[model samples]
Target: MITLKNVNVNELESAAQSCDFILPIEQTAVWASYQATIEGRKPWGCFIIQQDEKPLAFISLIDFETHGYHYVRSMHGPAWLEHPTQELETQVLQALATQLKQADKNLVFMRVDTWYDNLAVPVLSTVPYNQTVIISLEGGYEEILKRMKTRGRRDVRKAMRECPATCMDETERAYNDFSEYYEVMVDTGKRDGFVPAPLSDYTDMLGALGKDHCRVFAARVDERVVGWSIITMHGPVAVRYYAAMRSDAMHMFVTDRLLYAECCMLYDLGVTHYDLMGIGNDFAPSLKGLNVFKTKFSTEIIPVAAGRDIPLRPVYYKALTTAKKLRKVLKH
Candidate 1:
């Protein structure tokens, strides 16, 4: 029997660090790395899948009142990837829905853009809200790069020639994008209204992910860091979770160069694809340039569905959504 319940930070650690279904996105380090960065998080429903009292799957749920929806992150495989079948998936999804349905009424529905490939469910993109990207590692690094359009290689080379950089290996004493890497991100986020998670979130990550799958790359001029990239590994994918560069760094193509270097490193490590986390082409007009840039290297666009929401109590869902909307207007 699969029993579901809320998990603590320690329990999250167990699910994230396990060897069976271990992946970077699920790693406590990767999640905590973005701690202070995102806001409006609810912690009650980070559900763990257990079979016979042993954890076998892990998934997180967030109740977002702005849209009156619940977002499900990393919703598969607290167990071995091969463990969940079509029937079990249905059961698990239903079970997860039951948990969220009990929450406030504001939750209109559940939108689950899970870790599973966009291809896994062909019709998912047709849903109300969704975003995702596909990656390729089928060929070795050289081959993948060769597959790139000319501009892709050109930006990479240009960045390399001008960027000052090196890898802060995961084991390198201690450093973080939230602290050591804050400047570049700050400059960029301030340009918008974005804020990252607090610093303490990353402190928890260092202990959880260990040194094997996390890294921070800083682009510096002389001794000054102009930009940095924080990335984590999950299975065969090396995801670029956060990145930004200073005015000079951006012009010098330092940020792009850093990513190119990561691509090469990932290739050497036998990792196949480098996921440039996301480029909200649909919502972030300011990022149109980046969306265009990422396309130069990516072979295809993978659409991810919105995280699904199901409130345990219909009334609570209504109230939550109303409160959320009111709060948004007040802030504005």
Candidate 2:
């Protein structure tokens, strides 16, 4: 029988390390702590699932509320410790939904963010992009460069040689330098047609995650910041969660150099995988512009499982869905 047991962060982290499972940064304890810093979000719990006393998977969840409806979200989990089959995933989700509902009467649903592939279940809200580019950081810096596309390699070299931009780890000075990064982010969002998150969101994230798990890399020309990338690390994986560059500095290829330098730094820290986060695909065409930039760093695009919302209260969930649709229509 499959059972979900509550565990602490250290226990869960240790299990993942012992099993050699790559725990996503979003599912880490640090991420839960970061979520706690955000309003309307709370660290629910960390859990380990077992089948007949053998550990199967681990997940950390955060509780959130939307329009007065409470829900718990598991981001990039449950990370399986053993080889997972569809049957196992189905069983696990079913069991998790039931258990979570029993634990919190106010929770209307549970959102399971995908880390697996081809989940045969209905998803109310899908991930922004179900596919992403992952670069293996196993080999040395030169070997890592060899895996990049020709354009990527040339851009990095040219950015280093011709551009006066210098990239360095600025995590220690993240507070002092964050204003510059945020200014660039706001400009990038305006240029890209998206709204950037509030300043406190990024600041709280950096403060909560700290320097050990999060690093801020900045590319500067003449001592002025031109680009920035925020990387989050957990176990053997490092994810580039946020990146932005000044519109005026685009010609210098600062971002290209910044990411390459970040990858090298991660590799040196014993990180095995560098996730460039989401990329545009046929299903998520809105993000296609990201493909031109992110794909240059890696040769392969990885398809992962998408998120699913398992409703515990059917009537309430239906009402919530209708209200959400109405809001969208009203906005338009």
Give me the candidate number with maximum lDDT.
2
Q: Write the per-residue lDDT of candidate 1 for residues 1-332, one digit (tens) a residue.
A: 77786876457656656645554364343454344244554433466766676766666544333343443333322333344555666666667666665554344455554434221322212222234343565667566667666888777767666555654333363443346556666677776567855556554555555556666666667767777666677667777766667765566777666666667666767677777755555533344555776777765666543333443444655676677678889999
Among all windows of 10 consecutive residues in model 1, the one with the lowest summed lDDT is 118-127
- How many clashing pairs in candidate 1? 41
Clashing residue pairs in all predictions, respectively, total 41, 0
Per TM-score, the best of the predicted structures is 2
TM-score of each: 0.66, 0.92
Candidate 2 matches the true fold with a TM-score of 0.92
Question: What lDDT does the true structure give each of the candidates?
Answer: 0.56, 0.82
Tell me the spans in candidate 2 whose CA falls farther than 4 Å from its real position. 18-22, 115-127
lDDT of 1 at 170: 34
